[model samples]
Target: MIDHSIDRDPARPDVGHGHFRVDEKRWDSTFFGRQIGSLSWTELPADRKAGRTELGRIAELSDAAGYSLVECHVGMTDFTLISLLEDIGFRVVDSRVRFLTRWTLADVPVTTPLDGAIRWAVPSDRDRIVELTHEGFTDNDKFCSRFKNPDYFSAGDTRRYFEAWIDSTAFEADAASAVLEIDNEVRGYFIYQVRGEYEELPVVKGILTAVAPNSRGANGHLAMQAFLYHRLGLSDWFLDNTTQLTNTPVIRNHIRSSKRLDEIVLTLYRRPAA
Candidate 1:
């Protein structure tokens, strides 16, 4: 048996390491009527056996919980563990790339709409926002596959996931949910949260942003970006952005605006209840 001391490394910051968990809520298992488990971890015990044992335990527990599949997120730097996971039957599904931007007053664009438009979302906007979210994420990076495998994932599942997000974001006090209105109609929306601290500097994170497919050319996206940057820039906050690797449009836009890629994550999956 491997010593548990690996988790208490004195040389590494307590928060630097990652953890593995089964997030049932995020996957909409109850709504979808399917048990899906998410496995994530940052550091592995030096004892490979222990790491494998832990993963095996997770798989077993997921099976017991009636999970049909287990999704695992592995960072690029953790190749050793990746190889181990692959050997144990997990196949890569999708990948995520994390980008970071240090927003300041200087980074704010002068072209952003200065009008007193762009307001926080209200209860009346929930249905439309959910619809927009469902449409925007149908081809999301996490499950972006040309195979069109409904058994693995479906548009209905995507809608359910966003429904949960909208429901939860509405109740989060630290969250900022905003929508762009043109001619008194919502065209785009964004969800952000004030999270994390580095050297006491606050971090503003964008959880989701989407423009109605039909409204793409109306500058709704730019308006949303400009509004958030200007708002966060006022506090000299650092910005964290994450997107799936297949989201070329969003990635290209961020890069064009000077966002730097910080990390790449690979999400692998094992099916048939482990």
Candidate 2:
């Protein structure tokens, strides 16, 4: 998801004053057919004045290094970076939201899914999962995500992203995935991960989820939530999910389930001018 792998290598102090680093996003580069890079906290300048000058240098260096696109994310309240980002032509493309589930399930009512079944995902379900990945999210969705930006990502690439996400994060420690079956056929899937001691408390994150086009209705979404609430209610882990605000299903679930809005991040993208 958020790629929190920032430069925490004790080599720099405060991510430094006159330093910059752009991590090459290999997956994004290959998927989009262009050199894509991302700026980390290490690249953040000290002040607005330094930011204006340093960020401009970062852009030029990135272009000289063959990066045609660069991305960065900062807290929505970080006005210094926001203004500096705008100075260099970065436009907000996505809003990353963090919704926290404090404890037990909220007092929201959900419709029981008709003929829907849920089970932990197994190796055999890979092919069916891929099939859904390709067909589940379509143009008909209220909104998909950062990957669905047609100006930069093709529909085919978007599907590949979902496939890649599941493949890459499926077996990490404490990761669990569930598949939703409708009428005895696999129609949706979601991944959940728990960090036993992340941030000094057990933290649970909703990694991602997808439902087949045939099952994108209220029943399908509620079924997944029912499963999530069931699992979350079992432990006292600090549960949360970072999703695009435009993702209607998740936003609805947050409101319906009473998940508090804890944080909001703005993801900005800048493409090299042709």
Candidate 3:
């Protein structure tokens, strides 16, 4: 297991208030020494001073490692501290509508019938998921380019992308992912992690979801959502989806299908050489 003890700040009053943990790991050469992962402070109480101190440490390390990018998803309820992050220069790379739909054994909806089949992913599905992910990006040239960019997902970097997802799923299956198949073909998938205590309110943190071009319709979207709700049975869940404000169709869909929970304005700041 990765050693988180080094980053742990014991005296912080909000340390575990909201299931928050200050964890950091070495970044790969691909990220140029920049530690490229999240710091989970969602469970911490909203203390501006504490939040700033924690973020300052992160910013210092990121700068030393030459990492210019940092991304995080905070609970909608943690407004004060999230705003503090913006003041420190970490730009909101993207904003996703947080949506929740309660469920019970009785409230389970019928699976949306589609051309494809849905099932839990296995080791055998890895290659197919990788292939579909790379190919699906082609439908949107701009989207593909972001990944293809030298700073991001370059051509043939599919291995890293796929491996990241695989590793995440292996580490936490409950909140990891589920795949969508069609006639035995892997067409799309969703990656999430179960959070919160069962005794309290349970929530699913949806990290990523994608559908192949051929599967980009209401059927495909509904199928994926249905599968997650039915299989996971998470009563309260949140989906942090990334989309441009200009994308009217998607924005409209999120507003309609998922209740708007919070809005965050992200801005990136580049630090001058120390």
**TM-score leader:** 2
Better of 1 and 2 by lDDT: 2
Ranking by lDDT: 2, 1, 3
Error of 3 at 141 (Å): 3.5
Model 2, 1-274: lDDT tens digits are 4343433345432222255567677656766688777776544555668768877877777677677778888886574677777888788888888887655455434446666787767888888877766665544466557777887777887777777777776556567777888777888887778755544666778776778766777476567666765765354557777887777787787879678888888888887655
**lDDT values, one for every candidate:** 0.66, 0.70, 0.53
List residue ranges in candidate 3 displaced over 4 A: 1-32, 35-93, 100-105, 137-139, 142-162, 197-199, 233-248, 265-274
Stretches of candidate 1 exceeding 4 Å from the true structure? 1-67, 110-117, 139-149, 153-155, 231-234
Q: Residue 39 in candidate 3 has what lDDT?
A: 48
Tell me the lDDT of model 2 at 237. 57
Candidate 3 clashes: the total is: 9
Q: Over the stretch 1-274, how does candidate 1's per-residue lDDT look in tens digits?
A: 1111122234422222123445443334555676655666655777887777777666666566566766677787786788778766788877788887776767566444332257667789888887777666755545474222465777666555557777877437777777887678877788887777755778777877777766776666666767666655355877888877888897999899789888998878777542
Please identify which of the two predictions, 2 or 3, would achieve the higher TM-score against the true structure: 2
State the local distance difference test value for candidate 2. Answer: 0.70
Clashing pairs in 3: 18-43, 19-43, 91-267, 92-266, 116-182, 147-153, 175-192, 175-193, 175-194
User: Candidate 1, which ten residues in sequence have the lowest lDDT sum?
Assistant: 1-10
